[model samples]
Target: MLTTVRLSIIVMVLSISGDLFSQIRNNYFSASHPYFNYMGRVDSSQREYVRFDWPGVRVRFRFTGKELKLYFKGGQRNYFDLIVDEKRMGVFYASGDTVVEIEGIKGKGPHSVQFIKRTEGEMGEARFYGAAFYPEGKLLPWIGNSTRRIEFIGNSITCGYGSEALGRDEKFDPRTENVLKSYASIVANAFQADYHVVAHSGLGVVRNYGDNQPVSVNLATMPQRYSRILDMDDSSTWDFSSWCPGAVVINLGTNDFSTKPHPDKAIFQRKYEELILKVRNVYGSVPVFCLVGPMIDEPCFSYVKEMVENFKLVYNDSNVYFIGIPTELLNDKDDLGADWHPSYIGHQKIANFILPVMSNILKWNY
Candidate 1:
């Protein structure tokens, strides 16, 4: 009787294990799968993959499982911040193989996660292959984005460089930055609009921050890499044809003028206006708002406004507009992030100022 009981127990255990294995799906999805959310220009990778370099570019997926994992391969060393549900998780460096699975969410759950790249474009880009889920895992469909799309183009400020750090003097680390916490993301989210961020650190419209290397020897600036998917190289071009934003916000020239005795005012104004025209030609009739920063003050600020006025009048373009963040907010040390960048509250302050401006301009309900 004891032997028979033991054999019966073994059979029950085997049955349960079989059921669990049956529910497990080790399937790898195509990189182009709609379940992923991308925030920048992306290009098709070999076979079934997608790659991007714009800081803060990432993917989101939903699954019904107790455990979830991601598969990715990155060049050089790359990092990403994981947000499970809405809670910010730790940052993880990408490994060549599958990452350890995230399990036991509040013990067990059907969880949603957003994987955001925390590094700048100059550092490296991440290529995501797919995700994994266990025990009845299923991928939810892509979150449909019905609102008018908007694109923010600029430098580190737009990239959220050091936006999460505590001190103004704290050296900026890629891990401390979150592009989603930047003013661009804040404004986009406030208006329920999908956004594309094309930004890098220390890059400018016509010059680089503290680097005086001639164009022949220096890295590409914003205008040069404007249409490229990867910021480092021209390996692939962004198919602007695939998606169109109703408006484009440009916040540049900070790096160009970062050094004392800035670039020639006449030349800077000309190049700035030319950049505006280029954006107009690409997006076609989309309102182009020339944005300035809280980092800028006084005479420099006055110069930017003058350039905007000239661009609008010169091109006879009524759609081109100018908006500047309040300089007073820049003095608020508590709202400052690392290396003199804006913190989360600082970003919110800018977003708050522009939320109404965008709403009225875009005809958004918010």
Candidate 2:
């Protein structure tokens, strides 16, 4: 009788353990490592559609619990695929949740997890605000798996407008709100890196909004937004120690060239010099890629490139490099997005050119 009772107790304990294991499985999307970004945008009560300040290119997701569902409704013909830990999970079409069997390590816990999503062509840009992980019981895991950190500096284009819906007037697709699908955002995804943006609409190194003020020849030429200088002065502005990136990409010449009557050539050069010095000081020993112009026309492109190269030579810093997008890339008839932003397909091309250079800088094989 004693032996039989002992056996029954053992059987009960095993059964309970199995049930608990299954429950845990349903609650998480476990893997070796997991990481994701928050989709930045807020919705309004009356407008059904939310206003997105940035484009909805692609968002990263990391989960330790069970499943993930990407809810979207921008395109009907669009297709996508998810890659986790360099393994192809499967291909999925637009507007659906593609499930995968998350293979997690057995005993020592997961080492890391990654979710890479890609879209092709110009069906419609996605607007992503945040991610929803199943079994919402535990806090999302943060495994420092980022291979590179990128900072994009540009204008409204960099802000990620028209990547989603048009504005109120019909100049573009007013139906959709701005999503997080900007070209820079997409490029960051292709490389699986952390990215930050320091761009605004109609901003220049010497002037702001619309070049309302004349360019200054001395320290006065620096725009208020150029406060990155102050940040560098005090470490509190940015702790490069914590996020010392391997490479930095600057895409600013566009706004500078767009300013009318052209900024005083001399002032522009001086401001660019100061900007480069500040960047060099903060990110010591890191490569800085300065882009000339995307759709920036004629003499302006040559002017900016000349300044960039001359500055590099002056500082004797081999870390500085320059590239030009040329008119060929902007051959697409619709260069003017909602308020002159790049569209979904436009962003993909931008990503193609910029990603390669960035990869080379970071020594990424892709």
Candidate 3:
């Protein structure tokens, strides 16, 4: 009788384990988080560029020895401070990965966590993972979801630029860096879609003071180093197999008009046309919107206007559009947040204007 009772207990335990495994559909150890087993066992592994950007909350969950270290990326201002699972923790940026260890969490059970961040601005980009796993365990099955992905390609303005709104000294002061509250974050929140931002400060399609590279007197205005996405190589970086963006919003031309002399007007026009063609080549029928700069000047502005006319004449299709942002939109002193980036309010205005246009493209159910 005793032997039979022990065997029954073992069988019941195995049955429960099987049920738990089936409940989880997809799980993976985010390269942004410390390595751990599904059973909640921590393993030391070098986490890669995993990142999360939300407002007022930034967290990094990693394993260092038996302890779980929680690294907090700083916030805009100490409006409220960060609260995780109802506990307060200090925040700091991890130029590299900051080591951390978690305690008390164990097993394959579900972990529910809530993050509360204060107002001055929040570094909400906190990401974590459980183990080195992927959906379907290395088998990427085709998901036939007719979903539209949108990719925004541009410069620091695209990157949130003046979102920090701090002075030059305060810009990188380590006190005001919050990636979570950028314009991309704001737009993504509004769109409720997967968004990718490929941007850098002071980078232009043609050569810029930052890059310090001279182009042939001949080649068109340097396309915003499209090849930069592919390690400065032209070997198929823009392929959109898994992430075919349905529409691409191009917000460049800002840095191009900097101190650098605008490329010969003709070259500029051709380069813009060619860039659009290349983008369409990879994305196929994806819609592309060319946004004129909020600060485009006389000659450059006229040139862009001409280019828009030429592109429309050539393509003669609605798939490509030049969204003219009037200077009136730029009249607000608040538009220039910092380092020539749009302020939070400025970004909102842009979003408000673009939202209707984008919703038209996305056919959002209003």
RMSD of each: 8.2, 13.4, 12.7
Query: Pick by TM-score: which candidate is best?
Result: 1
* lDDT over C-alpha atoms for residue 65 of model 2: 39
Query: What's the TM for model 1?
Result: 0.85
Candidate 3 local lDDT, residue 257: 66
lDDT of 3: 0.46
TM-score of each: 0.85, 0.59, 0.61
Name the runs in model 3 displaced over 4 angstroms: 1-92, 100-146, 167-179, 209-224, 227-239, 330-333
Please, what is the whole-model Cα lDDT of each candidate in the order they appear?
0.73, 0.49, 0.46
lDDT of 1 by residue, 96-123 (tens): 4334356555534556778777667776
* Poorly placed runs, candidate 1 (over 4 Å): 1-25, 34-37, 74-77, 105-111, 213-217
Writing each residue's lDDT as its tens digit, candidate 2 over 1-366 gives 011112111100011222332344334432212244322211222222221222232334544434343333333333333444445454334332222232232222232333323332133333322333444423344555476777666655665555553422335332322324677778777877776555555556765435545653332222344333121121113334444566766666566566565677787767766777777787786787777656576665776678878977787877777777765786444543565556666667777888787787668755
The lDDT, on a scale of 0 to 1, for candidate 2 is 0.49
Ranked candidates (lDDT, high to low) = 1, 2, 3
Candidate number with the higher TM-score (1 or 2): 1
Best-first order by TM-score = 1, 3, 2
Off by over 4 Å in 2: 1-136, 165-179, 216-223, 226-236, 332-336
